[model samples]
Target: MVDLRGIRHPLRPAGHGRLPAPPAVDRVRADGRRRQGLILGWRRRATVAVATVALLAVVGCGSTVSPTPGSSVTAPATSATASGAGPAPTCGPIPPVAPPSGLDQAGWWRDRTFYEVFVRSFADGDGDGIGDLKGLIGKLDYFNDNNVASQTDLGITALWLMPTFPSPSYHGYDVTDYRAVNPDYGSLDDLRELVKEAHRRGIAVILDLPLNHTSDEHPWFVGSKTGTGPYADWYRWSDAPQGNGWQPDGSRFYYAAFGADLPDLNLRNPDVTAEVTADAEFWLGTAGVDGFRLDAAKYLVEDGPTTENTPETHAWWRTFRSAVDAQVPRTLLLGEVWDLPKVSASYVPADLDLTFDFALDTGYVGAAQSGDAATLMRLMTNVTKLYPATSGFGAFLSNHDMNRVATQLDSDPGQLGVAADLLLTGPGVPFVYYGEEIGLTGAKPDERIRTPMRWDASSPAAGFSSGAPWESMSDDPPSLNVADESASNSSLLSRYRNLIHLRQLHPALSSGTWAPVASDSSSVVAALRVAPTETALVLTNVSTEPVSPTLSLESSPLCGRPAVFGAYGQTVTIGPELTAAGGFHDYRPVATLQPQSTVVILLGP
Candidate 1:
């Protein structure tokens, strides 16, 4: 059937799976028209063996949850009693669950906060009307204040850059040259300097690698079309054309699962895998990038219905991971699996270090908007069990593929605070999309969602670029820009900064095991984070009206001191309430939580 001579490398292992196909959308034309396009995807698998160092040894254990300029709201004098208290609060560490089947116990990811950057919209160093590497270089201080005592930096430790390689498309997903940087962004030297500067501030840089397909204009595809040289078998082809992607090319038909100008790489061909692997090595070894966001990972290898999550695909990822780990032992591999948690989580313990947690994204947003605390609490409880104990997902509210979060929550400041509280306090490595901190909002047609970062409201271009932006800025920049929000004590930008710092300060909130504290109200999602040294009770009132919900937990006295809070700074009081049948203590608050507010209480033993 298929030739195996080139691919059956001795070190390569094997694996398999199936994923629901992603919705197919039109590829944007150079003229900006919507036409049928290939699906952009990301793939991943595990390594046969970890070498050089004990992966578990290099990674540290634990996590923390965020902060702002305002003071924490103090609790009132009244408290709840065990006998009158409704549901008894569940206290203590949740049993240490087993790591997902093959989870690599590399915990280094726990300490990093990933920030997604769409290069074209980030900042423009040149007056070419497009954001470039030099512009990103200039903004490094914004991410880290360079050891400044003020702590004004965004404090993000990892950067997930959308594809940086040369491509014919504006999105850069249909890569034309794997080894070179797109001239629109900058030169290879510019990228090197960017990486060097980022590392100088203790930040890790990871480039998005689109490995599923290449621009039809790629030399390998052109060569393969003629069935000449080693490139002859570099892409999928058939004499009797079949399936959704079959397209005519000279004497034979080739497959393009995404854009018309893109051709799916025939990863079954060992040469293709070898070449892609080499490209990764170049970036990791020569370019000095920390890792990669594997784009379009699901469509790596097709089997019958579609080329997604097939056994061969997992096997290839394993080989790929091995090659990368061999070069950089601590390098991270985050997969872009835009599927359900069950489907995406399947890639972990072996395949990827993390997958974007779409469940939490949708769950938190939905519950926050509708005040359905049960749904949010259920999602959190389930996800904690689904993922490996040692590994975690990329907790995010919104990314380039989806509508901006501010747009999702209709720009409600309280809903935004609830979202930030859920994501930063929950267990996982969180990624904040650029401009999200300033409450950026955008909707469909794609370009709107990728608008330029709003750095200043006073400037005509919002301080993102001196020249015209590649895309227009969001209309409300004057009120929502970073320049204005950074100064306000109660602004969304200040909220995000404070929240991030909160996590950096507390180890329990970040890496600790999560246990849901039973609450009687449907409007509030309350839970406790328990670590060896500390315990915290997090409460969110997803309602628009002030509601006082009882939080029943077995823990001792709550300090009545709010560790971190958002929304209306109402006073909260924790007192003894009625007891349940089990004699567990009920903790009810004396103060009402204002609509859309969240509070974190540090409990004492």
Candidate 2:
């Protein structure tokens, strides 16, 4: 596994291993009542006596809800309003957004928003103070309630669950049993139930599969240590310690890329390949997961001294892809090739259905931090040229391994909003880390980055658990927790909810050709999302000063006036189109973007 912290060392302390059996507590069902409590609490806090004119101004056309002062943008209205006219929204079945033209309807992952869930730190259903499948199951509605009209849910279409297999470590990366579920999380049956529930809400579930290595305590590694058994040769070994990654297993040294506790599996062995392939089949065919987030995909089959992006790695992925396709036709293989766009793109259209764009992630975070849009604009232009299509890449801000985006931006909600706007509006599938919506802040040392989800600010455990949390909650939960933010229309959570649902409502924003829009100001980044029947103009002012960028949309396919779909402290003015000598219409669009704000405009037929 490539070090997430940019350090090639074990994240946990030495002697860190499986946690002891949790003390049994009464199982709490994450049912409608619990979900209602969360919504009602938000309503109670947000409700205020206001003028009728203000209410009318706040609720715009097409279910738009005006955000509070200093908030980011307009969000869709949810059932749980400040008025509290009905029951609070709950976790329940939600329908998937319809696929746009040229996209496969069966490939439900495309044009969808995905949420990365670290199961252990998500929620505690059994009062064990650790997140489990049952807890996740209850919270599925918070991700997507399947109601097109409801704005309470996050409107995520897919989930990328961190490893759930039984392992010897807390992170669950080093698998001990590929087939069995981690007892700390739940049973295999609980996993099946989770898949069932998620699917019922039209949410696709993909597991984190670290095929490169297994825990040293695994049977295969245990048997291979002696260099004699049915599992002999299952792991690479040598008479002497070969190089940097080799660890002493008695007299013989074995390859352990991440650490000694995790042994690299000899995937070149045919039997090992077959066994791993079968394990994948088990999850798809039996457990009913939709796909896998292949961890450290580029380092799967290392060559001598060159342990990353090897030719053998591509070949093995092809073999794995073919085998999985033969068994399960539409299963997704999303790889984590944490490298430049060129290297990450090489694995797509053949080896993996999609790969995370590490370069884009850097560009996005950097632009937000520096407030200079030139680098981000250049990167987006290059990305449009490099990838096979927009769907081939996955765009994200920060993940569990990196410092939280909020912390990276120094907890500035405006900058956070700008970053989120770029991620959702830009091409490729977007993945949101848990608690990112409410601007949860955390820095590295890994555990802090993967802290418990802050459900309620007032709760002792931040509403993640009735008992003690697996890890301490992030520092600013009082202002950043879900309950408080859900109530405030101007909160970061509202901005995220608006942006996510806006993507769902518009096809071009989700799956369309990206073309850069030339802007006069270096602080403003602009692009056009063009589809057959729809076109969207996304403009962001990365700087802290208002920028009225004169956009050169001469090369864009847009024609006529465009309407504002969503705006945050921005106003648009459509400039007159001029006919050029080549019989082409040259269009100019001008937008006055507020400091650290974004606006989405739609060009209709």
Alpha-carbon local distance difference test for all models: 0.67, 0.72
* lDDT of each residue in 555-595, candidate 1, tens digit only: 33222222122212333344343233222344554356666
Query: Estimated TM-score per prediction?
Result: 0.79, 0.81
The reply for model 2, stretches above 4 Å from the true place, is 1-106, 559-572, 575-591
Best by lDDT: 2
User: What is the Å distance of residue 434 in model 2 from its true position?
Assistant: 0.5
lDDT of 2: 0.72
Q: What is the lDDT of residue 101 in candidate 2?
A: 21
Error of 2 at 87 (Å): 55
